[model samples]
Target: MHRTAVVPCATPPRATRRLALALAPCAVTTAPRAWAARETASTMTPGTIRKQIFNDARGRATTYPPWMLGEWTCATTFVDASFPRRDVDARALARVPDTPGFRALSVARVPDVGREGTIEHRVRFVRVDGKTREDVGFNLMEIIDAYVGADAVEAVTTDGDDRTTIRLKPRASPNAERIELFTNARESGVEGDAFYVRESFRQVSLGYGTEYGNARVAPTDYEHRWTYTPLPDVPGGAVDETNVNKVHVKLVTAAYVQGQDALRLTASSNPRGAPVPKLGDAAGLAFEPVIVYTHVSLLERVGCVP
Candidate 1:
């Protein structure tokens, strides 16, 4: 076959159906944009990254002008819940108010059912500026969820939803993270002005079993404002989606843990020691925090990497 569909649509159909995982190809999906000098945005500044692009939530045209970065090629049209609250407009509902990431649902159960998909982005922009050591000031795009419709990209087939390289950093403060080890586990966003990074994915080792406690993956985010050169009404350099400016939400959390932080997150798959990867599975013993897939992207920037 001549594969290159990468249509995980940034995954969000219940994490492509409980992790039937597969969609890699995109020249090996992620892990190359300087793989992780991301000390979790160390503490992003630059006037809090230009006051988080003036988070009017999606109003003042969402504000932009922090010196726009590089790369460009984003074409997403996901407005789940079958997109039609009469075409949402309270400033893009301030970026998916609820629906986890818009129309999101299916952390698997309890009358759960809601999802949406459509992804096309091969983003790339790095501007950490923390000064060398691979800079870590802020702005670190890296999307990559190709395949744009056109025959639903041949019906799509991959399901290996391991976050599909979906790593967006920007959280001066927001990850309240109440606690939930399954069923839509906890995660929320919109610390406005910058920091609209939502996430989900809790299926584990499921070649056909071990759902790793299923926190019901499928949820997405990675917000950023604009600056001098964009907003010709968005969609530039190709691929487009009608009126554009759309987003939704989701959530259902439950799972909980105690006991020395569950024996300190099972003795280190990263229980605060940091490096990242502290959920469950791989014998670390599952209590919660696990991961898998669920994406819905739109970065747009195919340049500037030097």
Candidate 2:
């Protein structure tokens, strides 16, 4: 009689560790052109145009030439303490300022961190006018943590740490057609770091251009997801359920700059989320959120002339 031996099915030791790392918490990571109508040049100065653009926090005016219309993509970048360490170039995205079609961009803490130190937020706008091009505007917001170097800053992952929420109000006008919004969130953490950070974004669009000013409005939707976890070499021993974590939402804007291009400049805001309880099961870490709102326009004109 002969007997046969069965080999046991088992994951390689290294493979098991790799799988664990793959399941660790992490981070997250558009646009275009065209034209339509033409309008007579108005004697309106840039100041007047800016004022008109800023009039309604929830609306936009048509300072763009009649030829400016169709679709445009907007781009923006944000930076926070939780961002992974990387080369900081002077020409980096977050270092740039805001521009036109890029209105109402901001950054802030949830509960107001008091005035400890400052965090920089930027926005920029660009447009085409005939063969010439112009950057409509630029701006920046330096958000300071009120508490500064306090324990709250160090234990940002701890529950009840200072947090903030930032908001942007679009400028409205009679000739304006529509508005849309989008955002991105990124974060990093070690395995035993005690807490995790997360982010959330929202936008609201209003319709304009043609039709009755009070006609029913159409809406759009946008959202993002990311996860963070400790690197094998991270010192804290790896995050577990016993630790506390924080979630932060960094908001960036994408708007349509009707006319020569389908996309406009991008804007950003820094908004942190409340602290979240950590869980020991690293395999179950996940990041997902629902987009609050989006708006689409029906105007047939370009935002800039070019």
Candidate 3:
């Protein structure tokens, strides 16, 4: 299908992002040998892999390859007996049970066409690694400048092996985006196979409603993220090609908004004493949050890579 972004001073509708997430019963999916081969290539040293273990060290963030086609199966969720539930932000877990997660398949395709106009693609929610559940339509990400950045989230299950863990140090210029995340190696870890997607957005426009907040518009800038950690079957296991993993369609509707009279809080700023820089009331006009409703999915390759 053909999609074009030809005009300036205007924004396109954001794609319904489905960072493939799923919840399957305790059924193990043995990622083929290709998974193992790729993991071997990224180790910090020979015969040693820097996987998540009971340790504390921050690895330098490297400009690693983002998950493109030919390297990943669809995101699949099995019973993650080893998820890092303690690391997740408390605000994200409120009103939801602590034992919940979305381990699903996500599909992301970005053309290597360089920094030209804009990049566009769709994320679909499918079931059993086979059929389509819903085609959450494509979203648009317009470029802010010619400066594109890079980052990666690597999670490889050890196939229940006692893999040695290496200390990771923080790296400079870790991501292409202006935002740096999970910089410390201690902030990085892995578990069962599940892909959680997050988009970095830049606010474009704004308006005001009768609400206490601001009126929300589509984003002017955004980036795609597809991260999953899965166990690799090292000594090899029976490839149950027939056991299908079930799919669950999750409706992700969140708001991205422009700030109002809100002040930017920092390490030294305190409302009671030290000064804090605040945004404008803009003629007593406040805005509401931009409601973005997207979906996430989990799927596997129709055929494992050989």
Candidate 4:
């Protein structure tokens, strides 16, 4: 499942270096009462993500543990991808650009789909209600614009409830002019230093039909589960100028195609305009795992901390 691929050189920008040094230590040294009492065995482990269903109709924003707070420069490498349900077929094994399954899974492109390599990005986390919460709006705009292109992403916005929406500019397709995406956390929890959260998204590719009904809007639903485990700090990893400790964490992220969206997208010749039919209860259905990415990151406290 692993093949060698090009890895981007590791070097932080001048602005990033300045931000890292300006940050003050904000992570709580001791486990808070709420965090210490909530440790459980259900947190996911690497290579252990199986088919398990749950209901999260009224999910809310995730509250993270103290150790997870801060800005981080992450270098993520794609591990592998597979179609557990639709195996033994050409479409199941197709590359990211060669198939619409990735789009249906709410993924624009799978970095190094045919191989394994690293991509670097920066992310920020801030204190909320005495805990930690990621800045979704800023993070998505920074990451996605870099992943695709600044010209492709028109805007990225987050609501008061933490729901995020991304708008894309027009493409070359005659029938479509733009795309919109709505995403939010469906469920989240912390089991000791390990944290897990499921994020659901609805991606709508808008077509240029004259009328609203005939606009050819294609709505696709998918979700991703991320499991994070903090690693112990090393002695020499601390910066001398800042005197701030760095936190390390192992992150495992799995993308899943909910219900029949993936099946319909893969079967359609023109997937961009395809209609996704409503299915039965989402919790009762089995999700198709499309991609699993794993990475270990070095997190540094930044001035973004509240």
Q: Model 4, residue 192: what's the lDDT?
A: 62
Flag regions of model 2 displaced more than 4 Å.
Answer: 1-77, 80-101, 105-202, 205-234, 246-306
lDDT of 1 at 141: 17
Q: Give the lowest summed-lDDT range of ten residues in model 4.
A: 27-36
For candidate 1, lDDT tens digit of each residue in 241-294?
Answer: 332222221221212122233333334345567534334421232222111122
Ranking by lDDT: 4, 1, 3, 2
User: Against the true structure, what is each candidate's TM-score?
Assistant: 0.22, 0.20, 0.23, 0.57
Using TM-score as the measure, which candidate wins?
Answer: 4
- Per-residue lDDT of model 3, residues 164-219, tens digit only: 11111123112111121121121222223333333322322222334677442222
Name model 4 segments beyond 4 Å from true: 1-57, 86-105, 108-116, 150-152, 160-162, 169-185, 207-216, 235-287, 290-298, 302-304
In model 1, which runs have C-alpha deviations exceeding 4 angstroms? 1-16, 22-105, 108-193, 197-284, 287-289, 297-306
lDDT of 3: 0.23
Query: With candidate 1 superimposed using the best TM-score fit, by how many Å does residue 1's alpha carbon deviate from the native?
Result: 53
Residue range with the least summed lDDT across 10 consecutive positions in model 2? 28-37
lDDT, residue 94, candidate 4 = 38
lDDT for 54 (candidate 4) = 33
Q: Rate the local accuracy (lDDT) of all candidates.
A: 0.24, 0.20, 0.23, 0.44
